[model samples]
Target: MDDAANPLRIPPQMSVYADKHNLFHLLQRMLTGLLIDQPEDPISYLVRLLQAADVPKIMLLGPPAVGKHSAAKKLSAELGAVHVTTDSLLEDQSELSAEARQYALTHQEIPAELLIQLIKRRLNSVDCVDKGWVMEGVPQTFLQALRLQQAGVIPQHVVMLEAPDDVLLERARGRLVDPLTADVYHQTFLWPADDAVAQRLEKRRDLPEEQRLADLQRYRREVTALTSAYQHVLRVVNSDQPITDVYQQVAAFVKTRRYYRTPRILLLGPPGSGKSHQARQLSEKYKMVDVSCGRLLRAAAADGSAVGDEVQPYLDGGTPVPDPLVLKVLDKRLSRLDCCSRGWILHGFPRDLEQVRSLQESQHRPNRVYFLEVTDDVCLERITLRATDPVTGERFHVVTRPAPNSEVHKRLRTRPEDGVDTVTQELRLYRKHTAALQSVYPDAVHIDADQDFHSVFEALESRLTAD
Candidate 1:
C-alpha cells in the first residue's frame, strides 16, 4: 500500500453500521452540545446528551377552520409531543409582556415582536424541549414567522392544511365543541361515534360572518409570504378529504425519512446508460468530484503501489475484482477533501446489495441516488460497438458517432473488455442484481437513458436544480 494513498483509513463497514443505527445523528447532536456549552467535563456532557430526550418539534399552520387543530391533537398524542398553541401560550395573561397584554385586553392584534416574545418563552420551556412540541396556528403573519425564526423556534416539520374558502366557511358554520373535553367537532362531518359525546356537543359560538370573512381575507393576503418563509420545511396538504385520509397523508409526510443534506449523488443503471457522461457534465458545472470507480482503479493500478499490484491482475485478466479490494480503493478516494466538501458524483460501483450495505456505514453514502435505465440490447450495442482511438484516446461509436475520417479511424482499437462476449456477461450480472439494488434505493431518481444524451442530461440537471 502507498503510505500516501490513505493516512486515516477508517473501515467503511463501521460507517455502514453507524448509519443503520443512527449513530451519525447521535454524534452530530453530541458535537452540537460540546459546541454550545463548551463544558469542562466533555465526556460527562456527552453522556448527558445521550440521555436527553429527542422531542419532535412540529408546526401546524392553516387558515381558520382548516383542520389544523384536529391534526395537531392526533400527532401530539401519537408522538407524545407537547401541543402548544397561541391560546395555550396566552392562557396565563400575567406571563404576557405589558405591550402584548395591552393588545389582548383591548381585543386587538399584538405586534409581531411582542407576540414572538411570548411564543419564544413557551417554546423554550422545559416541557416543550423535553417532550418535544407540536404548535398549532401561531405566527399567522409573515412578520411573526420571521420573529419566531429569529428566536430559533425551528420545527423539523411544518404542515399547512388547506381548503377552499367556501368549504372552510361551511365547516365553521357547522363546528361543534365538547365543553367537557374541548375537542372540536363538525356537526356535518365529524359527529362523535360515542352517543354520549355526540349528545353533549355544543354549537360553538360563531364569529360574525362579516368578521369571519375579514379574517379569511387577511389569511389569504399573508399566506404566500408565510409559506415562502418556511418553504424548505413546509408541506401543504388538502384538508377537504375525510378526516382519516387527511390525517394519514399528514402523518406519512411527517414520518418520511429526511435525506442527508449534503450533495453526494449516486448514479446507477445498466452499463452504457450515459452515467459517465451525465456525471462528467454535473462535475464540470457543480465542481464536484467525479468518482468513477473504473477510472480510479485504472489510475491506481498504473501507479505501481502495493494497492495497484493487487488489483492489476484482476484488471489484466478481465475478471471481476473482489469486493474488499474495490472498497479499499473507494474508501481512499471518497475520503479526499474535494469529494467531502465540494461534494461528489459516484458511478460504476456498488453494483449490488452487498456493496450498498458496506457503503451505508460510511458518511460518504450518497444522499441523492439516480438510476439511468436503458434496455439490455441497447447496453450491448452501446458498449460492444464502441472503439477507442488509441492515438487520441477518444471513444467513437460505430452506429451513433463515427471517426471523422477513415485515416483517423484506422488506428481505433477495441479493448477485450469491450468485446460482445464480455459486455453480454456484464449485462447478465447487472440484470440479476438490478431489482435488489433498486429496492435499496426506492427514492433514487430513475431516468430514461434510451433518449439522446442531451435529453438525459437535461432530466438529471433539472432534478439537481429542484433541490
Candidate 2:
C-alpha cells in the first residue's frame, strides 16, 4: 500500500488468533499497559498508532444513563462522522414488530439478535460507509459482539464509560423522550426552559427503583464480560466528572483517530456587552471566520438578495428581524462559511429561547456557546461612549480610542441609538428577551466581560486551549 494511503502500517506480528482463548490472551498482553496504569489520558499510544492506518469506526458501550449516546454524538460531531444509535435505528424501522417497538420504548434491552440485524443494516448504508460512524447502544452482550465481528462489522475502538450507579439512576429518572423527533431530554440538565416545549415533552415512565437496580446489575454483568473480550481496542473514560472534562477525555482520543476539525463557536450576550469585539478577536487568533448574523442580514439587505429583499424594509425601519428571516439569513451565511472544514464564530443569532429552539431544530447548533456577562450599568456606559467611523464602520471608545485631533474628531459619527435613554431601553429589552437563555443554555461558558479586554481574552483562550 502507498505510504500516504496507509499512514500507520500494521506490523505483521499483530494477528487475530482464531482460537477464542488464545485471542483473549494475545489481547491481554497487548493491552496490559492500558489496563494497569488507567492513566488520565485514556487513549493509549498504541491505539493512536493503529488508528492512523484506518478511518475510525467507534463503538460506545456503557450502562443506561451513563452518557454513552451523548458522548458518541459529540465524538461524531467532532470527527465529522455519522452518529448511529441503535435505539434510533429501531425507532426508524417502519416494519418493526409491535413487540420490538414496545421493548425499545421501555428501559430494557432489545433482543441481541434483533439489534445485531438492525446494526448490520445501518452499517451497510452509504452514509455510514462513506463518512465513517460512531455508534452506541449495541453489543451489550458477548453474543452481540460475536455476531458483529462475524458479520465483519468490528469497531476500530470501543469506549467504555464508567459512572457511579447513583449518578446513572438520577439521570435515568429525569430522562424524557420526544417520540416524534426521537430527541432525548433530561429534566435536570437538557430540558428546554421554554414552557411550550417543556410542557409538551412526554416524560418517560420510570421503572421502579428495585427493577432499575436489577437492570443495572444485569447490564454490568453482561458488558464487563463482553468488554473483556475486546480489551485490545478498549478505552475507559470516567463520566462522573464535569461534562466538559469528560468531553475533553473523549476528544483527546478522537483527535488521535482523525484530522482535527475547526471549532464551531457561538457567542451570546446583551447589546453593548462587547460580544462582537471578542468574537472578532478570537476568530482572528484561532484562524476562524467571524460570522455575525446581524452583519450578514444588513449586507444581504443592501445587496438585494432574495432574503435581503424581504428583510430590507425591517432593517430600514430599525425593526427587529423576524425569527424566520433571521434564521434564513443565518443558514445561508453558515452554508457559505464552509464551517464543516474551516470553523466559524457565530454571533447575534439565538437571541431568545425561541431562537435557541429554532437553531436546535434546524440542526445548525454550535459545539460550544460563550455567554459574555456584563452588568447593565457598564453596558449602558459603554454604549454612551461608543462612536463610529462612517467610512470604515469601526467602533471606538471615547476614552480608549479617542480621535487624536479636532480634524479627526470631525469624522466620527454617533449612532442614533447611542443616547442614554435609548441605550437603557435597548438594554431593558435585551434583558427581557435573553434572561431565559441563561437557564436554557446553562452549560454555556460564562465569561466576565466586565474585565479588561486582555484579561477577558486570556480567560477565553485558556478555556479553548486547555488540554
Candidate 3:
C-alpha cells in the first residue's frame, strides 16, 4: 500500500511540517484507507484507528469466568500495555487511604464513591497514563462507566464477552481457587498436579449458582444501559468457543486487525494416568506455564490464609473439598499470573462433568483436551505401589524409586487407602465418576497411558505438534 493508503504509515512531509490542518488531512486519508472494502461499522473502525498512537484505555465487561481478564492480559502484552483489574487493586489495600481500606474491609461491596476514588487514582498513575491499559472488573454498572468518564478516565473501547446463561453457570460451578496465590482453575478443565494441592482447593464459595445467575441477570440489565451509552465504541464477542478463538476475535476487534493466537492445552485422566508427567514435558517443550491446581491448593492450605483455614478441615478428613471452593482457589491463582501471554498446560482437573461445564462457563475452555487412557488394572497397580513422605508429601514408587536404605525406608509412609483393597475401591470410584468423560469430551485426543512412558510421550508429542 502507498503511504497515503497505509493507515500505519506517515509521510515524511506530514511528520516534518505537520500542522492541525495537515494532521486532520492525514487522519482523513487514514480513515479512507481503513474504510476501503471494509465491512465493519465505519465510525467504530475510524475511532479505533485514530487511537492507534495513543495509550489504549479499554474496558472489559463480562460475567465471571468469561476470560475477560485473560483477554485483557493478552492484549496488554501484545500492545506493550498495562493490564489492570479492580480485584487486584482492591486486594492490596495498602495502596489505598486508610479510610478506604477500612470501608472496603467492612463492606461486602465497595460503594461507588470509594470505588471511584480508587479507580481514579489507578488511572492517573504513571503506568496507565504513559502506556496503554486493558482494564477489567470495573464500571460494572452504567453509572460507574459514566462516573469514570466524568473523572476523565474514559475508555476508547468497551468489549463485552458474551455467553449463554447455562454456559456461565457451568463455568461458575467448576471454578476452583488457591487462597494462597489467588490462582483460578476449572475443575474439569484445569487443575494442579499434586493430590495434596487438590486437597486444599475449594470451590469459589462466593460464586454459588444462585448468586452467579443473579449477577448474570443484573449484568444483562446493566449491559443494556451501558451498551446504549457507549454503542459507538462497544464490541461484543461470543465466548462459547475455545478461549484462544475467543481471544482472537477480541484482539481483532481491539486492533481493527488480525493476529495469530497461541493455544491453551488441558490434560485430563484418572489417577495414575500420567497427566502430570506429560504436562511437565509439554510445558518445557512449548514454554507454556504448567499450572498444577493440586500444588496450589496444598500451598494455600499451608499458607494459613482464610482460604487455607477453610480447606484444612476437609483435607484432614480426607473428604473432597466442595467444587465451588476449589474453583475459588484456582481463580485466585490464575488471576495473579500472565497465563494468557505465556499459554499454559492445565493438569489434574475436571474429574467430572460439572467441572467440564465450569470450564465452558468461565470462558477458559482449552484449545485441546488430552485424556490419558489407562486400564483399571494399571491404575490400581500404580496407586497400590505409591508411597508418600509424611513431612513433605512427596510421592515415591516402591518398585521404581524405593528408599536407598532401611533408615530411609523407615521414614517413608504409605497411605492406608493405597492398600490393594483400597486401590481397587479407588479404581471403581474413578470409573464411576470419570469414565463418562470419554464420551463427554468427544473432541479430546486420547492416548494410551498403559504403554511405556516413552511411547505415551511420543504419541502426545506427535498429536500436539501436528497442530
Error of 1 at 139 (Å): 7.7
lDDT of 3 by residue, 200-295 (tens): 887876645677777888888898777755554677899888777888888877775212233467888777788888888877766677889788
lDDT of each: 0.81, 0.72, 0.70
After superposition, candidate 3 runs with Cα above 4 Å error: 1-260, 388-395, 405-407, 465-467
Worst 10 residues of 3 by lDDT: 12-21
lDDT of 2 by residue, 215-259 (tens): 799888897677655654666799888767887887776565332
Best by lDDT: 1
Q: After superposition on all CA atoms, what RMSD does each candidate show versus the true structure?
A: 8.6, 21.9, 27.0
- Model 3 TM-score, all chains together: 0.42
Best by TM-score: 1
Model 2 quality (TM-score): 0.46
Candidate 1 matches the true fold with a TM-score of 0.56
Q: Model 2, stretches more than 4 Å misplaced?
A: 1-261, 389-394, 465-467
How would you encode candidate 1's per-residue C-alpha lDDT over 1-467 as one tens digit per residue? 47565554445466445545656545655665576447799997676545443558788999999999989999999988889876676677564655576777787998887787787778656777678889999879998998777665666678999999999999999999998988999978888899999999899888899988999999999999888677656788999999999999999978764423436789998878988999999898667889999998998899888888999999999788898898888877776645654568999989989998877665668878899999989998899999999888999989999999998789999988789888888889899999999898888898999989999987886566234
